[model samples]
Target: MSGFSPEWLALREPADHAAINAQVRLELVRVLAGKASPKVVDLGCGAGSNLRGLSPWLPAGQSWTLVDYDQRLLDAAQARVARSPLSPSPREGGGTSVTYRQADFSAGDFAPLIAGADLVTAAALFDLVSVPVIGKLADAVTANRQIFCTVLTYDGIASFLPEHPLDRAMREAFNRHQQTDKGFGPAAGPNATEALAQAFTSRGYRVIRAKSPWVLDQTFERLRRELDQGWANAVRETGAVPVREIEGWIAHRLAAQDAVTVVGHEDLLAVPV
Candidate 1:
């Protein structure tokens, strides 16, 4: 799997937290309500943004096994979480406990990581993986009767205000590049949410999905700038558009004072019926 730097993850964390679907989270709260302590395994944890976002809603005394390919990120996650109010010392009683594990599910078995988890959760991950991998995940979750929740999966919709002539072309090229392998097989990309929903539903699990789009305005200037550069890079990789046009589009987007960028994403909550 591709690695994400802590700085990049940090920059996007606020938007990611804001974009999470409240309804899906409410449903998850209901699903795990009765458990005294929920064991959650977070895939591609990446500095533990998902944990920091969702931990407060969960029951106290929760235990988390944060799994990531990068040990540096795991270390970062631990340090950050330790500083948060959420990670109170265990002696305080009912405080959350966390452990980090370095593992690459793309090249290793997933069953062990999820073996005893009550909930298997990930954020900003499914879109980068293949359908078969999702299916296998559904199978394991079903077998263990674990609740599955994933958020911030890109769905191929990106719109910018004060639209440029090359907007459509840039978006098309970027979406195509998204399907390229990110260490997994060919990615599902924009179709990931639908694929994940179908995978769980076909196994008789109840799946709920909701829109979780990033709506960035002037207040998110830094994130918008980063996104502009990232999209330009991805579009360049496809070679479907001229380099000059891509550069122009990025320049126009960054320079626009009243710019707004909305990137569509979806969140899913699957529960065993």
Candidate 2:
């Protein structure tokens, strides 16, 4: 899969943190109750935002293995995690320890990475992978009996305030673009949540899913603008809609007053039954 820039990852981290489903996180915490030094593997650990956001809720003395295809991102994640107050302090006994690995799991086996992990997690990742990739991950997690949690699997829901005539078309086209090869075969895209649920449930795992939508308003103007531009680009790639119409749609969206966008996502937790 293509690597995301640190800048884009940084821009989205706050929204990602804010959008986490409280109930799903609580369930994850519940499953991880007794381990003083739990082992976690974070796939595609972009800037380690997931760690920064989730570490405080986990057990003390946690050890994390952060894996990504890009060494630069891995480095950024390590540095960011080390500095974040939300992460466990770097003091002796109760401090959290982190290891970074550069690997393109898309092209090779990732089973080894999660071999002894108590929990395997990823954020904003599954939606870009193929169904077979998800199945492979499910098999690995189930075989190891590791808890699995993934958040921000887009659900094809994009609603913009002051609705425009071309919004639906743009959204549909963009979703189609999402399914294009993202270095993991045909990407699951908006169908990722259902794919994940089915994959785990069929393996006798109990699955919990909750909505984790990004409710962007005026306060998030920069992110909102960037998101709109991204959508427009994806829609253009599909060629399912005219370029002029897509451009006009984005212009209207960006220029509109008090615009709000709700981009739907889901958080999934799969625990051994």
Candidate 3:
């Protein structure tokens, strides 16, 4: 919830599934290109992963502004940008022409900072925002005609060897948990994609939807562990079953020596319609 638990970040970064999502983000940039110097703003930038990923595709002279609620992530993102291949000013001329800003996207008016940017983006954030807030964002972006993209939304499919029923049960429960908004009021969870798509279409932007699903193979231990924990927590949160049963079910799946794959989808690419 706060900073993605360090263990979670460690396992997530090296995930093979992440590679697919990164590729989708890259393509999102390619589809919306037509500017001399685009001002790219990454909303809920989250350590600047999306920014760093977009650097190569973006114009060399282009500027970037990273926004997040956490200062710690902002600090780390700036440091990464300084060392990134796309650093605007090399040779110690200046430390990355990138600007880091702290802002709350849930309640505050976003048009002033984002209204005129060539592009605005976020990773794995759409499913977590409520419909009304997304409506406001669609209004703002439509007014400015900013290109927007988001990546890695969870679609809730988990499979392990032997095909246990618990896997299906846990996944559904987790999807429900994902819908529970953390602090930005009520959100409809994984279904946020539709709200975003509808909002953009109504405003007159041609939307290109791409699904980047994370399909993990059995060889990846880190991904297995992350999915296991995520499934367990989702089931536990519901208080619908006994803790011992959940433990036993998880143990059985992990103990079996076979390939396990969890499928999750992320939506990408929204342009002026």
Rank list by lDDT: 1, 2, 3
- Alpha-carbon RMSD to native, per candidate: 2.1, 2.0, 3.5
Candidate models: Cα lDDT each: 0.90, 0.88, 0.69
Per-residue CA lDDT of candidate 2, range 1-273, in tens?
455889999998999999999999999999997877999999989788888888778888888898888888988887786676444634324767888988888853769989889999999999899999999999999998999999888998999988999988988898898898898999999999999999999999999999999998987878888998888888888999998998899899889888888899999999998
Better of 2 and 3 by lDDT: 2
The sequence of per-residue lDDT tens digits that candidate 3 reaches over residues 5-41 is: 3345435644523544555566665764556567788
- The residue ranges of model 3 lying beyond 4 angstroms of the native Cα positions read 1-7, 14-27, 83-96
Q: Scored by Cα lDDT, where does model 1 land?
A: 0.90
Q: Residue 18 in candidate 1 has what lDDT? A: 92
Which has the higher TM-score value, candidate number 2 or candidate number 3? 2
What's the CA error at residue 96 for candidate 2, in Å? Answer: 1.2
Candidate 3 — which pairs collide? 204-273, 205-272, 205-273, 206-273
Query: Judged by lDDT against the true structure, how good is candidate 2?
Result: 0.88
